[model samples]
Target: MADKSSSNAYWAANVRIILISLVIWFTCSFGFGILLRPMLSGISVGGTDLGFWFAQQGSILVFLVLIFFYAWKMGKIDAEHGVDE
Candidate 1:
């Protein structure tokens, strides 16, 4: 009863985190790099538009950062629930 509820809460929190991360990844890689490129044209990086930088490099960098962040966050979550390995 209580244990099941707690486990469900943990899974729900985990899924929420994953969904938020995915949204950010999508926004950075697709929304910024392609859909919003024209709107961001005024912002330049190395004489090229910011969109180009995001498409070519920025998104990947952000993805890497997100990976590390997710790992760290999940570690804390696991520890809180006594599920750490």
Candidate 2:
């Protein structure tokens, strides 16, 4: 059925979007915040470790941004797929 096909497409699009967002989330959080902390040690923020800032605040901010981006992008995707109601 055409409706079924469109629904599948919509779901696929959503899944892809989520995967991309998660990769970005991990890169900003664990990668920069923990694994790469040493390299950024000299760049102090608020008189504390740059890595600490990334692990705590930066990640949180990036998460919020990703959440908003996902919501906004998915809304448009849904509308395009005629899945918005």
Q: Candidates' lDDT values, in order?
A: 0.91, 0.91
Candidate 2, overall lDDT?
Answer: 0.91
Best lDDT among the predictions, by candidate number: 2
lDDT (10s digit) by residue, model 2, range 14-79: 999999999999988998899989988999899888899999889999999999999999999988
Pairs in steric clash, model 1? none
Q: Write the per-residue lDDT of candidate 1 for residues 1-85, one digit (tens) a residue.
A: 2388778888887998899999999999998999999999999899999999999999999999999989999998888777787
> Residue 31 in model 1: shift from native, Å?
0.9
**lDDT accuracy of residue 23 in candidate 2:** 96
What C-alpha RMSD separates each model from the true structure? 1.7, 1.9
lDDT score at residue 15, model 2, on the 0-100 scale: 98
